[model samples]
Target: MFTKILIANRGEIACRVIKTARRMGVKTVAVYSDADAGAMHVAMADEAYHIGGAAAAESYLCYDKIIEVCKQSGAQAVHPGYGFLSENAAFCRALAENDITFIGPPVGAIEAMGSKSEAKKIMEKADVPLVPGYHGDEQSIEFMKNEADKMGYPVILKAAAGGGGKGMRIVWKAEEIEDAYEAAKREAIKGFGDDHMLVEKYLTKPRHVEIQVFADQHDNVVYLFERDCSVQRRHQKVFEEAPAPLMQNDLRARMGKAACNAARAIGYEGAGTVEFLLDEDGSFYFMEMNTRLQVEHPVTEMITGEDLVEWQLRVAAGQTLPQKQDDLSISGHAIEVRVYAEDPDNDFLPATGTLTHLRPPQESAHVRVDTGVREGDEVSIHYDPMISKLIVWADTREGALRHLRKALNEYQVVGLTTNIEFLATLAAHPAFVNFDVDTGFIAKHENDLFPKREHITDDALALACLDVFITRDEEAQAQADWSGDPFSPWHSTSGFRMNDDNHHELYFVEGDDIITVTCHYRDEGYVMELPGGDVLVRGERDDNGDLAADLGGRRMKATVVRHGDNLEILVHGRAHALKLFDPLAAAEGQDEVSGSLTSPMPGKVVSVLVEKDQEVKEGDSLMILEAMKMEHTIFAPMDGVVADIFFNAGDQLEEGVELLKLQGE
Candidate 1:
C-alpha cells in the first residue's frame, strides 16, 4: 500500500477520499482554492496546500500546481477525486512521467471516453448498445439542423465534452433548433473549451440507470449493480437509488454483464461508471462512461458494503481484483438526495449567501452525510452550490424511502433558500413512491407539483396574528417597566382584558393590502376561536418573554408586544410590524399605490435589455442578472414606459433591489 496520496480536488469528494485513505493508514494531502480556505475537507486532510484563486480555472484546474504540490509533499499517488483533473489525459500522463501513480483508469481509456463523440465511436466498435443519433465531426449550422430533421423533433443536442448538464439542449421544434444549437455551442465553448456537439433522438421516458464498474491492473472487472438516477431537473440528477426499485432479476443480470463488458473492452482500470439511458420498453442504450468516481457513489457503497475509494487505492498500487462478479451483491436498498443551495420554486436557480444556520441530521448506522461546509460558511457564486449528500439505507426500498423522508423533514437550514420543500414533495408524490416516473416526470407534472399554495388555513393566519400581538405586548411591557414607574397606565391589569368590551384592534399588511384584526385574552393565554370552531392560543410567557405554547404540535419561539391598542408579533424569523388603534383616537387613513418591480433575490446585474422611455409589454425581458452562476432575466410587469433603471450592468444588488420602474397612466 502507498504510504501517502494527494487529493487534487476539493469539497465533499475530497473529504470522501481522505476518509478511506485514513482508514487504510495512508496519509492524505488536500488542495484548496481561496474560497475553501476554511472548508471542511481542508481540515480533514493530514496535510493541505493552497493552490490559487477561488475560481476553478485558477485553482482546481491548475494541473501544474497540483502536480507540484504532490511532488513537494512526497505523495506516492494522486487521486483526482472526480471533477477537476480526474479525466484529463494530460494530467495522467504527466503523473506517469513523474513516476507518480494516477489512481484512475488508464490514460488511453480516459482519452477515448472523455469526449462524447469519440466515446460513441468506441462503444460502437465494442458492440455496446447505442441510441440512434448523429455523432460525426460536422459542426455546420445547416448540418446540425439536417441531422435533427432526420432524427425527428425532440432531439437532444449535447456537448461532446459535457458533464453536469452544462452544454445540453432539448429542441422540440424546428424553429427552436437553430437558436438552441447556437446557445448550446456557446455554453459548451465557455464551460469546456470544446464546442463539439452530438445530436441524439430524445427518449420520451428515460430512466437514468448507471452501472458501477471496478477493474484492477490484471484486467479483472466486476459490476456492483446499478443506481436509478431518474429523478432529475434540467438534466441533472436530484435523487438517486441503488438496486432500481422496479428492476427485474433478468434485467439486472443482463445490464451487469453489459457493464462489465463495456469496461473490459476498454481495458479499464480503477473505478469507473457506465451510464445507460433505459427506455420504457426495457431496452437500454449506452450514454457515456464517467472516467472517475460518480457524485452519487455513496448509494452503491451503502448497499454493497464497499469502500470504492479504497478499491481505487488498492488497484493503483498493483493489486488484483479482490472479488469476482458473483461475489458482489447488494444487500439492501439505498437512496441519496443531493441538498443544494438553490430555489426550487424559481426554476431551481442556484443561490449564494452566508449559511447562517446549517444543521445536518446526525449520522447513524443507516444514515450517512457527506458534507463539505459548516454553519457559517459562505456558499459563493464562484463554485458549485451543492451543500451535501444525504444517504439512507434499509433492507427494503420502502423502508429506505420512509427513512429518507424523515431525515429530510428533520433537516433545518436558514439564511439561504434551499430545495428541501421540493424534495419533500417529490418523495411524497404517488408516481415517485410507485417508481412509475422517469426523466420527463418533472416536465409533465410541473404544474401540479409547483403550483402556488392557496387556501392557507384560518388557524395559521390567526397564529400569525397572535404572534404579532405577543411581540408588541412584550415590547410595550418592557418599555413601561424600563421607565421605573410602578403605576404606569400601560401595566394596569385592565390593559390585559380580552373581552369585546376591551378588545384591541390590530392592523397588519400582507402584500399590497392591509388587514385589521381584533383580539381578546382567555384562560391562561389568549384564544381566538374561528367561525369553524378552530381555536388558536397565545400561551403564557416564560422568563425569556417567549410564548410557552405549541402551534400545530410544533413548538414555536415567539414574542408578542402591544403598543397602545395595536399588537405586533415576531414569529418564524419574521417581524409583523402592526398598527394599533386606540379607542381615544380616530382611525388611521389608508394610502393606495401602484405596483412596483423589485428583484426577488440578491445578484449581479449582467445586462440591461431595456432603456428608459421604451414602451414594453408584459413579460418582456427588461434586464438580466447573474447570480449563483445562472442568468435570470427580469421582465416588464405591465404595458408601460420604463420610468427608471435602478442599476446598470456589473452592479451588485441586494435582494428586493429595484431593477426597473413602470408608470401607470
Candidate 2:
C-alpha cells in the first residue's frame, strides 16, 4: 500500500477515498481549488494543498498543478476519483512519467476505452454485443443526420470523448435533428472541449444494466454482479440497484463474462464498469465502460460486502485479486439514489445556495449516506450540485426499497430546491416497487412520477400549530428557570387563564396564501382554526424532536423545524415549508411585472441569438445560458420586440440579473 496518496477529485468521492485510505492506515493528501478551500474533503485529509482557481480547467483538470502537489506532499500515488482527470489517458501517462502510481487502469486501457467511438469499435471486435449505429469520426451535422436517417428516427448522438448525459442528445424525428445537433455540439464543446460525436440507435424502452468488473496486474478479473440504473431523467440516472431486480442467474453469469472479456481485451486493471442497455426481449447491448470508480459504487459495495476503493488501492499496489470469480456471491439487495440540489420540476436544473439546514437520514449497517457537505456549506455553481448518495440494503429487494423510501422520508434539506420528495414518490411508486422500469420510466410515467403539486393541508397546518404551541410552552418553562423570582406573571409566556378564556392568533405564509391560525386554549391543548376549519391538536415532543399527537381526533406523527425564517414541517411523509407572517413588520409587497427578461440562475451567457430591436414571437430563443455544464435557453414569453440587450455572450451574471428587455409588439 502507498504510504500517502493524493486524491485528484473533490466532494463526496474525495471524502470517500479518504475514508478507505484511512481504514487501510494510508495517509491522504487532498487538493482543492479556490471554491473548495474549506470543503469537507480538504478538512478530512491528513494533508491539503491549494491547486488553482475555482474552474475545473484551472484546478482539478490542471495536470501540472496536481502533479506538483502530489510531489510536494510526498504522495506516492494519485487516486483520480471518477471525473475530471479520472479517464484521461494523458494524465495517467503523466503520473507514470513522474514515477507515481495512478490508482486506476493503465494508459493503454484508458486510451482504448476513453472515447465512446473507439470503445464501441473495440467491443465489436472483441465479440461483445453491440447496437446498430454509427461509431466513426463524423463531426458534420449533415453527415450525422444522414446516418440517423439510415439508423431510423430514434437515434442518440453522444459525445465521443465523455459521458454523464453531457454532450448527448436524443432525436426522435428528422425535424428535430438540426436543433439537437447544434445544442449537442455546443454542450459537447463546453463539457469535454471536443466536438466529435457518435450516433447510436436509441432503444425505445431499455433497462440500463451495468456490470462492475475488477482486474489485477496478474490478469485476474471478476465481476461484482450488475446494477440496474434504469430510472433516469434528462438521460441521467437517479436510482440504481445491485444484482438487477428479477435478474436470472444464467443471464447474470453471461453478462458478467462478457464484461470481464471486454476488460481483458483492453488489458484493464483496477475498477471498471461496463454498461449495457438491456432490451425488452432479454437481449443486451454494450454501452460505454467507465474506467474508474463510479458515483453509484456504494450499491455494489452494500450487496457484495466489498470495499471497491480498497480494491483499487490494492490492485494499484500490484496485488492479486481479493476474491476469485467462484468465491464472489451477492449477499443482499442494495439501492442508491442521488440527492442533488436540483429541481425535478424544472428539467432538473442544478441549484446553488447555502444549505441553511441539511439533515440526512441516520446511517446504520442497513443505510449509508456518503456526503462531503455539512450544514451551512455553500453549494457552488462551479461544480456538480449533488448533496449526497443515500444507499440502503436489505435481504430482499422489497425490503431494500422499503428502507430506501423510509430514509428518503426522513431526509430534510432547506434553503434550496431538492428532488427528495420526487425521489420518495418514485421509490414508493407501484411500477418501481414491482420492478417494471426502464430508461424511459420517468417519461412514460410522467404523470405518476412528477405528481400534482401538493397543497398545505389543514392537517399539516394543525401539526404546524401544534408545534408552535409546544415551542411556546417550552419557552415559558425556560423563562421560569431563568427568572430571579419564579412567581412573576410578567415573565410567564404561558397563557394562564384566571377566569376568562385565553385566545391568540398566528399567521403563516405559503406562497400567495396567508393562513390565519387562531389558537383557543382548552384542556392543556388548543383548538386551531386554520384554512379548512377548526382542529384540536395536542402533541408532546420526543427526545428526537418528533411529535406524536392527537389532531382532530386522529393520531399523527410530525416533525417541525424552524429553519431560518421558514417553518418546515413533515407529516405523513410529506413536507411543507411555511413562513411566519409578522403583523408588526413592514407590509409585504411585490415588484411590478415588466417586459424584462432576466437570468433565472447564476451562469454564463453562452450565445445571444437575437439582437436589439429584433422582433420575435412567443417561444423564440433569445439567448442560451450555461450553468453546471448544462445549457438553458431563454425564450420570449410573448410576442414582442427586443428593446435592448444587456449582457453579451461569455459574460457571467447572477440570478435575476436582467439579460434583455422587451416591449410589447
Candidate 3:
C-alpha cells in the first residue's frame, strides 16, 4: 500500500477516502480551496495543503496543482473521488506523466468511455444492447432536430460528455425541439464545456438501474450486484437501493455478465459503475459508465459486506481480485437517500447557511451516515449542497424502508432548510413501499410526494412557550455555576408563583400570524387558552436539554435549539421552526416594502433577463442565480415595469439581498 495518498476531491467523499486510508495504515494528504480551509475533510486528514481559489476550476479541476501537491507531499497516488477531475481522461494522463499512480481506470479506458456518444458506440460494438438513437458527431442544430424527428417524438437530448443527468432535455413534440435544442446546448456548454449531443428515444416509464463492476491489474473482473435508482427529480436520483427490487435470478446473472463484459471490453481497471435503462418488459439498454467511486456506493457496501474504497486502494496497488464471482453473494436489502441542504418545497433549490445545530441519526452496524459537515460549519455556495448519505440495511426490503423512515425522523438540523421530511414521506409512500417505482415515480405521485403545507399545532406552541420559560433559568444556572455560585437566587424564579391564580401571556410568530397564548398557573400545573381549544401543559428541561412535556395528560419529548429569534423543535419525527414575537418591536413598526426581488440564498447572479423600465408579465424571468452548481430563476410576481436594477451579470450576492426592483400597476 502507498504510505500516503492525495485525495483529489472534497466534501464527504474526501472524508470517506481518508477514513479507509487511515484504517489501512496509509497516511492521507487533503487538498482544499479557500472555501474548504476549515472543512471536515481537511481536519480529518494527516496533513493538508492549500491548492488555489475556492472555485473548482481554480482548485479541484486544476490537475497540475493537484499533481504538484502530490509530489510535494510525497503521495505515491491520487484518489479522485467522483466529480470534478475524477473522470477527466486528461487528468489521468497528467498523473501518469508525473509518475504518480491514478487510483482509477487507465487513460485509454477513461478516454474511450468518457464521452457518452463514444461509449455507446463501444458498447454496441461489444454486442451489448443499446437504445435506438443517434450517437453521431454532427453538432449542427438541424442535424440534431432531424435525428430527433427520426427517433420519433418524446426524444431526449443528452450532452455527449454529461453525467448525473445534467444538460439533458426531454422533448415531447416537434415544435418544442427548437427551443429545447438551444436550451440543452446552452446548458451542455456551460456545464460540460461540450456542445456535442446525441438524441435518444426517451422511454416513458423505464427504471434506472446500474451494475457495480470491479476489475484488477490481472484482467480479473466481478460484478457485485445491481442498484435501482429510479426515484429521481429533474433527472437526478434522490435515493438508491441495492439488489434491485423484484430482480430475478436470471436477470441478475445476465446484467452482471454484461457489466463485466463491458468493463473488460475497454480494458478497464479499478472500480466503475455501468448504468442502464431498464424497460418495463425487462429489457435493458446501456447508458454511460462512471469511472470512479460513486456517491451511492455505500448501499452496495452495506449489502455485499465490502468496502469499495478498500478495493480501489488494493486494485490500484496492483493487488489481485479480493474475491471471485462465485465467492460474492448478496446478504440483505440496503437503501441510500441523499440528504441535501435543499428546500423540497422551493423546487429543491440549494440552501446555504451555517449549521447552527447538526445531528445525524444514531448509527449502528445496520445504519450508517456518511457526512463531512458538522455543527458550526458552512454549506458553501461554491460546491454541491449535499450534507450526507443515509444508508440503512435490513433482512428485507420492507424492513429497510421502515428503518430509513425512522432514521430520517431521528435526524436533526437547524438554521437552514433540508429535504428530510420529503425523504421520510417518500419512504412511506405506498408505491415506494410496494417497490413499484420508475424514473417518473415522483412526477406520477406528485400529490403524495410534495405534501400540502402544514400549520403549527397547538401542542407545539405550548411546548415552545414552556421551552422559552425554562431556558432562561437554565442559562442563569450556567452563569451562576461559572461564577462558582451554583445556589444563585435567580435560578429560583423558574415556575415561581405568588398565588395559584397568577397568569401570564406569551406571543409567538408563525409566519405573518401572531399567536397569543395565556398561561394560568395552578397547583397541578398550568392551563392555557390555545388555538382550536384549551390545553393544559406541564413541561421541564432535562439534563440533556430535551423538553419533557405532559400535555393534557399525554407525554411528549422533543429536542430544541434556539438561534436569535428562531426556535427549532423536533418531535415525533417532525421539525418546526418558529419565532418569538416581540410586540414592542411591532409597536416601533417599520413600513412593509414590496416590488423588490431578492435572492432567496447566497449565490452569483448568472444572468439578468430584464432591464430597467422593461415591461414584463407575471411569471417572466427576471434573473438567474447560480448556487451550488444549480441555477434558480427569479420570476416576476405580477405584470410590472422594471423600476431599477442593482446588480450585473456576475456579482455575488448574499441571502435576501435585493437584486432588482419593479413597479406594478
Candidate 4:
C-alpha cells in the first residue's frame, strides 16, 4: 500500500477521500485555492498547500500546479476527486511521466470516454445499445440542425466532453435548435474547452439508471449494482438511490452485464460508472460513462457495504480485485440528495453568502452528511454552490425515504436560501413514494413541489409569539445583569399591570402580508387572539433551540432559528419564514426604484442583445449574464424602447446593478 497520496481537489469530495485514506493508514495531502484557505478539507489533511487564486481555472484546473504539489509533498499517488482534473487525459499522462500514480482509470479509458461522440462510437463497436441520434464529428450548426430534424423533435444536445448538466440543451422544436446549439457550444467551451457536441433523441419519462463498475490492473471487472438518478432539475441529478426501486432482478443483471461489458471493452481500471436511459418499455439506451467517482457514490457504498474510494486506492496500487461479481450483493436501499445553496423556485439560481447557521441532521447508521464547510463559512460564487449531500439507508426503500424526509426536517441553514424544504417536499411527493421517478420528475410535478404555502395555523402563530416573548425576557435578564439591578422594571417587556391582565401585541410578516396576534397574560399562561379563534399557549426554548410547548392544551415541539431579522420556524415538517414587522416603518413608506433592469446575481455580462432606443416587446432578451457557471438572460419586463445600456459584454457586475434602462412607449 502507498504511504501517502494527495487529493487534487477541494470541498466535500476531497474531504471524503481523506477520511477513507486516513482509515487505511495513508497520510493525505490537500490543495486549496484562496477562497478555501480555511476550508474544512484543508484543516483535515495531514499536509496542505496553497494552489492559486479563488477561481478554479487558476487553481484546481492548473495541471502543473497540482503536479508540482505532488512532488513537493513526496506523495506516491494523487486522487483527482470528481470534477477539476479527474477526467483530464493529459493530466493522467503527466502524472505517469513524473512517476506519480494517478488513482483513477488509465489515460486510455479516460480518453475513450472523454468525448461523448467518440465514446458512442466505441460503444457501437462493442454492440452496446445506443439511442437513435447523431454522434459524429461535424461541428457545423446547420449540420446539427439537419440531424435533429431527421431525429424528430425533442432532441437533447450534450457536450461531447462534459457532464454534470453543463453544455446540454433539449429542443422541442426545429425552430429552437439553432439558439440551443449556439448556447450549448458556448457553455461547452467554457466548461470543457471543447465545443464538440452530439445529438440524442430525448426520451419521454425515462429514468436515469447507472451501474457502478470497478476494475483492476489484472483486467478483472465487476459491477457493483446500480443507482437510479432519475430525480433531476436542469438536467442535473437532485436525488440518487441505489438498488433502484421497481427494478426487476433480471433487468438488474442485464444492466450490470452491459455496464461491465463497456468497462472491459475499454480495458478499464479503477472506479467508473456506466449510465443508461431506461425507457418506459424496459429498453435501455447507453448514456455517457463517467470515468471517475460519481457525486452520489455514497448511495452505492451504503447498499454494498463497500468503500469505493478505498477500492480505487487498492486498484491503483496493483492490488487484485477485492471481490468478484457474485460476492457483492445489495443489502439495503440508500438515498442521497444534493443540498445546494440555490433557489429551487428561481430556476435553481445559486446563492452566495455566509452560513450564519449550519445545523444538519445528526449522523448515525441511518443518516450521513458529506460536506466541506462549517458554521460561518461563506458559500462562494466561484464554484459549485452545493451545501452537502444528505444520505440515508434502511432495510427498505420506503423506510429509507422516510428517513430522508425526517433528516431533511432536522437539517437547517440560515443567512442564505437553500433547497432543504424543496427536497423535503420532493421526498414526500406521492409520485415519488409510489416509484414514479423519471428524468423529468421535477418538471412533471411542478405544482405539488412548489406549492404556495397556506397561512400559519393558530398553534404556529402562538409558537412564534412564544419565541418572541422568550427572546425579550432573555434580553431583559441580560440587561439587568449588566445594570446590577435585578428588579428593574424598565428592562422588562412583560407589559406589567397591577389591576388587569397584561396585554401585548406581536406583529410578524409572512411573505408580503403583515399579521397581528394579540395576547393576554392569564392563569400562568398566555391566551392569543387570532382571526380564527383564541388559543392558550405556554412554551419555553430548550438549550437545543427547540420550542417545547402547548397550544390550546396540545403538546408539540418545533425549532425556531433566528438569524439577523429573519426567523425560520420549522413546524410539522413544514418550514415557514417570518420577519418582525415594524408598523412605524410601514407607515413611513418609501418609493420603489424602477425604470431599469438590474443583475439578479453577481456575474459577467455575456452579451447585450438590445441597443439604445431599440423597441422591444415584453419578454425580449435584453442581455445575458454568466454566473455560477450558468447563463441567465435578462428579459424586458414590458413593451418599451431601450433608453440606456449600462454594462457591456465581458464586464463584471454585482447583484442588483442596473444593466440597462427601458423607457415605456
Error of 2 at 372 (Å): 1.0
Backbone clash count for every predicted candidate, in the order shown? 20, 0, 0, 0
* lDDT-best of 2 and 3: 2
Per-residue alpha-carbon lDDT of candidate 4 for residues 1-665, written as tens digits (9 for 90 to 100): 99999999999999999999999999999999999999999999999999999999999999899999999999999999999899999999999999999999999999999999899999988888999988888879899889989989899999999798889999999999998999998888888889899998999889999999999999799999999999998889999999899999999999989999999889999999999999999999899899999999999999999999999999999998889988999998999999999888888888889998788899999999999899999998898999899999999999999899999988888778799989999999999999988899898899999997688766677888888888888988998999998887788776888887799888999877889998997756788998789988888888887899988879999888787667877787666789877787767766555678888887799999988989999999889899866788899999989999999999998777889989988
- Which regions of candidate 1 fall more than 4 Å away from where they truly are? 455-523, 528-548, 551-665
Q: How close is candidate 3 to the true structure, as a TM-score?
A: 0.96
Best by TM-score: 4
For TM-score, candidate 1 versus 2, the one ahead is 2
Q: How far is candidate 1 from the true structure (C-alpha RMSD, Å)?
A: 5.2
Summarize candidate 3's per-residue lDDT along 459-543 as a digit string, tens digits.
7888887787677657777788888878866555345566555777788887777889988766676788888788888888888
TM-score versus the correct structure, for each prediction:
0.84, 0.95, 0.96, 0.97
The lDDT values for all models are 0.81, 0.90, 0.89, 0.91
lDDT of 2: 0.90
> Model 4 segments beyond 4 Å from truth?
498-501, 585-587
Error of 4 at 36 (Å): 0.6
lDDT-superior candidate, 1 or 2 = 2
User: Could you give candidate 1's per-residue lDDT for residues 205-303 as a string of tens digits?
Assistant: 889999999999887889989999998988889999998888998998888888888888788999999999999899999999999999999999999
